[model samples]
Target: MMTYQEAMDFINHIPHIGKRNGVNRVRPLLEKLGNPQQHLRFVHVAGTNGKGSTVAMTASVLRQAGLRVGMFISPYVEDFRERIQLDGQWISKEDLAEEVSTLAPLFRQLQQEDRAVTEFEFDTAMALHYFARKKCDMVVLEVGMGGKLDATNCIDAPDVSAIASISFDHTQYLGNTLAEIAGEKAGIIKMGSRVAIYPKEPEEAMEVIRKVCRQNSIQPNLPDLSQLEILSCGGEGSVIRYKGKQLHIPLLGEHQIYNALTVCAIFEELNAGGWDFDWETIQKGIGQARFEGRQEVICREPLCLVDGAHNPDGVDSLCRTIDRFFAGKQVTVVMGMLEDKDYAYGLSQLAQRASRFIAATPQDTPRALPAGKAAEIAKSYCQRVEAVDDPAQAAFLAKSQAGAEDVVIACGSLYMIGYAKQGFLREE
Candidate 1:
């Protein structure tokens, strides 16, 4: 009887698969496990950013509507089991241990046959098996990477699929151009399933998605951003008028408005598909949804904010939020990112909104860019740049240097945000 942590460690050590865009490995692996994913309804979500937030909001709404829902998101911010949750509760430790132990024999068999799988694949299989055993009404599945071959794409057909804001991230794996990237995300749009996309999607990306919808005979619905009227935005939340009614969501940034719209469009598609729910349920669910790493405020007096905005588009949105909400206030940014990310552009954009900068690295990640490298890049765009290898220490330093009205923001990679969150949460 291994403990839950032991089970996760075992899964971690099974095999290392680079985020190579391929479903070849995961499909056969799931097939061997009896394809539990085949029996469940799915709302498959895929995007460079906002995938987790959109799925979280959708799951929250569905849960509020009184349905048993399962949720799967990746690169967990706080804990390992946080990635797979059912009805707002994480997979119980006992269940995780038991499930992993039961899967041990299969893992060995696969290894012996030279078919060892990645941790993401194994996690996806375990989540599907657990969900099937519990018989959830449906699952909001977030794609780990490019939609085409992501392990989560093993589901036979989704009830609905969503493509949130597509942007320039994962260029190493997804391609340089937006069209190439959108084409990859459009891979999740299987025939017969409805899909909703961001209203202001790049023209090239929209063309790619429209082509896929045409190929699949899916008349994909696009959320009309123009219909959304934002009434007010603050650290507390955003109020917007949609369909002539005010809706409030307790999340930060204007970009989240579009994410909400994407969810609303999905709800409409689901309603059309015979899932009985209404706008009130959608509002309650969205308002209740809370994501840990994006615009999560851990402190109040001397504000400390953390966000998982490591790319150009994400950084741009964060900057907009800071400008809109924290105007006339000095802000110090503590940042870290993966070496492969477009940190030059990301850091420069962040520099525009920041009064000072502290560079740090996401502890323990193989892809973490060195803090010294980030400091060097910040030097080009910022007058005040300091390097700290430890993310927690960087956060503390920012807090110590801040005034009562000044803010401390930690942004870059989710792992970096996670590490800072652990440090801050520990103090509270």
Candidate 2:
């Protein structure tokens, strides 16, 4: 058996098979593995943002209902194994190594045929195989990118296909317009699958989702946002009333409350289909849910926060959270971004409230925006700007610049935010 490190190396070193137009490559691989995904029930989730939080909330509720839940997410914040989880617990290194060893010969054969799977495809296959082997009651699978062609979409019609708040992020892969992006996300909504949608999505996106639902003969479930009332909200968390039931959401930001509402809509569809998880169970599950690197507070003494808000919509959400929780505080912002994202728009939004900006490049990504280039962009919006090549040093510098009461926030690519989180914790 391969050691965990060797397994990781093997998976990482695998060459990307040229991208296909559909799930054609992944389907064949899974078929060779006896179609492990066919034996599993899935709650397929897709969107530009909030999909990870939604998946966590859904899996948490399922676990609360006494089900062995599997969660599959991509672009892991801290650990690589965070991509595959069961009952909120990450998959063991032993299991990952064993699975890699078992799949090695097949992978080698595919390589020999020049049909090697990409890293994400391989990860999706491993997650499906692991979940099936463990006999999970349900799996909450988050799309790696667009839903229609994402490897995770290889699964058959899911039990519940949830489309979170749609926005523009992956313009090259998904589409440019909101309608087109929504169409991609709505691809997860298959015939005979109950659908749940985030209520606060743009009308154009909602129209696309509604049309897709109509095509599938499914009436999409949406939370009554008019009925959602925030009882209290701060850095710690928020308490909100939805559909006349008070629910405490532990995840920070108003956007997260909307995400929880999407989870509620999901549970509504599940209950309507006789899943039997009541509102109380959902509330408990939501209250217990915690996600890292999204408005995550790592240090309280210097008030340092890390958020993975790369796109315009996500940056808007992060700004709103900052205004709500740290209003009037002198904000020192540490920002990093990928080259392909709408970083200019994101930096412009943050600049409106930021007292100073430290630009850093996200680690481990070929697409990272250079610290100097990001700083140059920030200079147009803010008078105070500095380029820091290292994300951890940027976090430390942001904290050092802040006073006891000043707010220090690191926002940008999730890749950098993970390093920022580690650095911020060290400051504490």
Candidate 3:
């Protein structure tokens, strides 16, 4: 039996065995493991920005409806175990290690056959196998990247395939244009699956998704965003009236309102398919749903927040949230980003609102933009800019420099937000 640390090490060290061949590389290995995903029901979610929140909201609602729900997300903000969850609880270390032990021999065998699995492939397999063994009634699966080649797309037709807020993030892999990227994300829509889409997506992207749904003989359900009425929105959360029901969403930001509406649209599809979830239960679930690191307020003394807004779209949402809630305030921003992202656009947007800017490097990623380089770019937009190589130190410095009534925000990359949160908590 492998220990938890050993299990994580083994999973993390798995080399990229084959070329990027879509689901072909992972399919055979899953076949050897008894094809566990085929035995599971899924609500497959894909998009650039809001996928995580949508998955969390969907899983929470399903769990509230007395179903055993499993959730699979990617690039966890804090812990590795966060990627795989059941009934809102993370998979235990003991179960993770046990599953890794069971799969080790199969992984070795695949490697010997020139079919080695990547870390994500192994993680997806483990999640499906564990969920199957636990007899979950449903699994909310989030796509890691572009939907067509993402490891989570290996599953069969989902009960509902949802595409949330599409934007320019992975242009190198997905495509440069909105239509092209939408085409890649639309790959998750299977023949028999019901589909839901965020109502406010760009027309170009919507056209591509509409074309795909047309080809599949499916009409995608979209949330009526115009029907959404914001009763109250503050740093705590938002109160919105949707579908003739006033509900409280615990996640912050107006963008989260959009995500909650998308979840509502998804559940409408599920209810139509005979899930039988009432609006009360759905409202309870939405109010109970909480995901960390997205406009998360870690401290209130100096008003420190940490957000994983690495791309232009995410930054735009964050900026709007700030402008709405903390208007006419002195704001200091600690930002970090990956080199592969549109860091310049994100930094420029953040700089417009930041009284001071501290650039930091994201941890544990080879593609992290250098802190000095980010600061140089930020200086073009903000008058006060400093480069700090350590994310935690940058967070601490930002908080310390802000007045008691001022605001300090750590944003940009999820890879660095965890460390920034640690610093903020320590300050608190």
Candidate 4:
């Protein structure tokens, strides 16, 4: 048996199947493990952005209704254990080690198949097995990349499959166009599943979703966007009125409001499907739901906010939120990005709202765009752009120049935000 740290090392080193292409390996791997995903109820969410917040809110609502919930997210904000949780608590290190030890041999055998089992596949299988053993009432599963080939899609079917706001992302694996990306996301809509969609999704995306629903015979569950009214929004978050009831979500950005709307639709769909969670519980869940790395406010004195806005759509949302919340304040951004993302568009979007920009490379990612390259591109968009060695140094240099009221925003990749948060954590 391996220690917890060793088990983590084993899992981390597992190779991916062609950089997020297909889940052929995960299917057989799960089958060998008795297909634990089939034994549990799930709410599967896939999209370019907001999937994390949507999954978190959905899990919180289910928990608020007094049910034991399991959550599995990808590219964890800080810790690997954050990827798998039972009722808000992370999987214990002992449990992770045990699960890994039990599956390690099977995972090795999976390599003999036509395609090798990737890290994501092994992680998905382990999470499902643990969730089944724990007898979770529901599991909120977030698709790691494109839905069609994502390992999480190994589930037979979900009680509710939701597509958060789909946009241009992972263009290489998913397609170049919006509809193509939507089609990949729509792959999560399977047989015997209820579908929920972001009310404001692009027409191209919604058309693809509608077609998938038609083929699967699942009724399209759409949120009534008109009923959602944002009464107040600021650095803390937003208070929105849905129908006649008001709810507050601590996650910043209007994109999160749309995500909450998608959650509301799922709650209604699940209630009609016999879950029966009340409005108060749903409101409470949305309020209590906590997700880091999406406009996370780390320090009030320096007014530091870290957002994982790696893609164009996400950057646009982050910039809009920053503009709304800190309209007249000086904003200095510490940015980083992956090589494959639309960094030019993302950087340009954030640059529109930034008074000063410090570019850095996201820590520990082979795909990271170099700090100098990002800084070079950012200079064309923003007047003041400088390259820093790393996210920690970029944050320090950015903060050094900012006054008390100026907001030090870190926007780019999740890894960048993760590194920036690490600096704050070390202080504590």
Candidate maximizing lDDT: 3
> What global local distance difference test value does model 1 have?
0.87
State the RMSD for candidate 4: 1.6
Q: Summarize candidate 2's per-residue lDDT along 205-304 as a digit string, tens digits.
A: 9999999999999999988878989899888889998878999988889899889999999999888887898888999999989787888788786888
Q: Worst 10-residue stretch by lDDT in candidate 4?
A: 16-25
Off by over 4 Å in 4: 19-21, 113-115, 425-428
| Order of the predicted models by lDDT, top scorer first | 3, 2, 1, 4
Regions of candidate 1 where Cα sits further than 4 Å from its true position: 18-21, 426-428
TM-score of every model versus the real structure: 0.96, 0.97, 0.97, 0.96
Backbone clash numbers for all candidates listed: 0, 0, 0, 0
Q: What is the lDDT, from 0 to 100, of the residue 42 in candidate 1?
A: 94
Query: Model 3, range 79-166, lDDT digits (tens) per residue?
Result: 9999999999999999999999999999899889988888888888999999999999999999988898888899999999999999
TM-score of 2: 0.97
For lDDT, candidate 2 versus 3, the one ahead is 3
Model 3 residue 267 distance off true place after TM-score fit, in angstroms: 0.8
How far residue 213's Cα lies from its native spot in candidate 4, in Å, is 1.2
Quantify all predictions' global Cα lDDT against the true fold: 0.87, 0.88, 0.91, 0.86
**Backbone clash pairs in model 3 (N, Cα, C under 3 Å; residues 3+ apart or in different chains), count:** 0
